[model samples]
Target: MSSRSLPTRQLATVLFTDVVDSTRQLAQSGDQVWARLLDALDAVSRSEVRRRGGELVKSTGDGALMLLPSPTAAIECATALHAAAGQLGVTLRIGAHTGEVERRGLDVAGMAVHVAARLMGSAGSGETVVSATVQALASPAAETYDDRGELSLKGVPVPVHAFAIRQASPPPVASAPLPVGDDRDAVTRLLRERRYEEAAEIAPEVDAATLAEALLAAGGRVEFLDVDITLVRMLQDVLDRLPADDAVTRSRTAAKLAFELRGDPSTAQDRRDLLDLATQLAESAGDAQAASEALLATVNSLWEPTGALDRLSAAERVITLTRRTNDVDHELEARLARLHALVEVWRIHDAGLELATYARLAARLDRPELNVFVASRRGMLAQISGRYDEQARQGEIAYTNAVAAGMPDAERLRMSHLFPIERDCGTGPDLFEAGLEMLRELTGIMPGNFYEADVAWVLLTLGRRDEARTELARALPPLLTSSGYRWLFSAVLAAETTAEVGSAEACQRLYDALLPHQDLLACVGPTFGGGVGERLGLLALRLGRTDEALERLARAVGDFDEIAALPWATRARVHLASALRSAGDIEGADSRLAEAKDTARALGMARMLAQIEAEDGGR
Candidate 1:
């Protein structure tokens, strides 16, 4: 009944070789000349294959695929082919990989063949790219290699570590004195002690490769120590002197420097530029893992809602490419980047699917860092879905894991999510206050204003309007041009707090700034909460725009009710009641207030219930 044929499998080393910029060459040379040149190139390729004991599968116009007995033979043949092609005035880009392939008569098929083709595409003219398997099988003396790092080949489900086969090995360097073998630890300790000039001077005494590694490690440690600008500059100077072809070192250094710059709001544009540059370098070197990392950095820096879809698309590409390479850590990170973009665009279902994949990968990889990150994301998702109990449980797990891993920053981030969950779950303000203290400690240690917006929200809710206003001032400047979860949350908090404590002119300015983004929803958990519209309504009411206030608050109540966010819906109803009273609908106001009170009582939202009672008493 089945018309499909099963593929016959065989282990072989697949090699793909192609002419670089063939189209451009074709355009420059007429059809006849190009045809003759390709013919000559094919003749040389066939001769090399026969001489090196390989079976030529087929010619793909300007490229050819060959099957060799072993990876060693494949590299040998490729090297000879490179030399022969050069002699014929044809520059060739070659790629080789050893894996199980499907032998279908004269042609071979399978991921191994495809991966080789992709690697060839990634190679430059006169260069040969090979997978880790090829590198492992080949005799080291026969071919020197430059480790290319991990690459996500097209149609591959995982990342592959590749190496560029050098034509010859370099001459050995004269042995150095000054304990070069033990310099890595010394450099690390000096960097840790903040002795930047001393570390910089000592780093160069070791070999270039070893020094690059030391700089990358030292740079990461310095980032945790409050982002020393002077030290970053020193590291950059060292990296700049290294070989341009050293992509792995360059990509890692660029990514680390970008992260350090991101901590300072003043360097936002620099951070963006550096990340984009890093992406280009990674792509040029065919380092998909590094490319994905750069893209994730770009996603983190993107604050505009208009760019969300573009960033999401880039993240998806990285995810697909990372998955093809079978790199668990990078794949999980790419998935998380995609998930963040999904959540920003209010695509909850897609985000959930990504989370599921992330969880599976984290478990399979047995990476504690991944587990802690997954737990943090799961806790955030649970909070959005109104599963406060699950949120609290996951939050605790994330916190414990973070602490055990010595990731203080991750612990602080989880605390940020936990504070809101505690409030919504009807946990007392004492715990919320404790969470704030932890956040304050983190801010003191890190010296960043990211926590100020969260601090403002808690202060406003506790009725410390003056303190909330101060915190809002500190949080608002950098967030003015930004959009997304944190930016939206900050805007909502500023709008509500300003309406209560700031001057009418200041409140109106905040209102005007927020009006354009009124349609953007605040992501609380699994659902879009009423925070944005409700705060907008309250600000409008304060500005004597009763009609606008009622309109916005009504929409807010509907959205909250649709998601079954009882506490949020209750808060929206209370605001709607006040807006109604301002519009001279006393009876409607009474009805809305009564409904809000009942919902608050049913949900055991003590803070919300108290607010409703206070509003009623004021009326």
Candidate 2:
């Protein structure tokens, strides 16, 4: 019934994966244990296959034959599954081949399948390998993949472009978690992490009385996921037994409730009521810090827009409470950072200053960790002000110091890319190198996806399109991607670089097509001559909307002007001289071109001048 007389040809990637050492593992284990392991493995495999757009065709014995919509997805699925199942002593090898295939029976059969099987044969024991057909689909995003020239397949007609997966291995300490590590101080560390509920969980796991004694001394926040309502009620009961004047204990209780209330609506109203009571008790005790903590708990239940103003008023109450009771604690500093993040989004400058004062105060406190945090906040403020250079300089020092002191990977990579953008090349190359290295080794790390895109941008600027393309290729598969927007922006910039280097109409057409995305416009525009460059480009194309160009560029100083980009937004002009030239005003064109060059000289963009010279060369 589903048969069609005519069959169409398309490039499809076929992947084959077989559980490595599966039989050995089973033979060494009890049959029951092996059975559970196999079932779980199959479940994970099936879910991953479906998510990656791979259609399962057959599962005979130890291996499965799957048809993937794209080669990239096949590789990604293979790499991730290898990591996910490693704990169970199950590893997988994937081989992908993309080419024309026949739709027959319940599956697609063709040379692509045979080649794919062969490719799989060529992969390392636990590696994922890819063929050339998959690599050629480069129009969507530029990717970095090494070209392994023609590989001789047993029966496939020719050699295919073959590549291998590369991933960074975790350190010896992190390769696998231990059954029990040195956790005598687990409750204290949990409290320090603001994981109140987690602290409570482990508190029982350890000595609860000792944990409680330690928490009373350590003074930290708590974390509670809202999924367990019964657990929260139990935890709340425990908190109710604690002394009201114990600030850290009260803060931890409030924080746990806040996380729960923010995440779930079933107990929202009740939580709000509890928070208000907590606030009152805190206020009555002249404990504004505790009251502010309670107010944060209340804000979570009302985070939605309809009640946001109410939450904001509550947030402001923290600042007011701090001022009234004069609690100069780190909580006040964090509250300021929190409020600034909110007000900055609304473009409220006065409110931002009030928030910034707290950052300055925190910086003066001089705790290394708090200083690092405050510096990062200042960098964010600088970014918001469009002073990207300042952001990079200040943020880089803090992030670098943090990393030197063994800060997390997320913070390190953040500073790396920030430096490159601000033209602080000190750490730029190393940042990109580390980023790419991470992508290859720990592909499953959530933040690796982000670092890949950003590092790709820097690589592109370095004239390493080929290298950048490799990184993009590894990251841009549509499987569980948050990389789409960045991919789009990167793709266009790559295309623009091609256009800028040559006068090719094809390159120009690609740039012309992608000009509409506002982010892309903003990104490419500021790097060039002036604001009018885009309008002038449009005017040159003369795609029949003369009025649009005329109206848009009317704010220009003249037709042939280029001094429009600036630190001098204080003074700039646009020009329509070129448009008039196309409209038959030769004298006006000469005058405009002269003026534009003179203005560009004043603006001091070396490349911008070169572009003008190249345009003259073409004429």
Q: CA shift at 378, candidate 1, in angstroms?
A: 2.8
Residue lDDT tens for model 1, 132-177: 7778766663456789998976556457778887774321222111
Q: Give, for candidate 1, the lowest lDDT window spanning 10 residues.
A: 1-10
> Tens digit of lDDT per residue, candidate 2, span 89-112?
777777876654543212344456
Off by over 4 Å in 2: 1-255, 261-281, 284-287, 297-314, 363-370, 396-433, 436-619
- State the local distance difference test value for candidate 1: 0.64
Candidate 2 lDDT score relative to the true structure: 0.47
**Candidate 2 global TM-score:** 0.37
RMSD of 1: 19.4
Measured against the true structure, the TM-scores of the candidates, in listed sequence, are 0.55, 0.37
lDDT of all the models against the reference?
0.64, 0.47
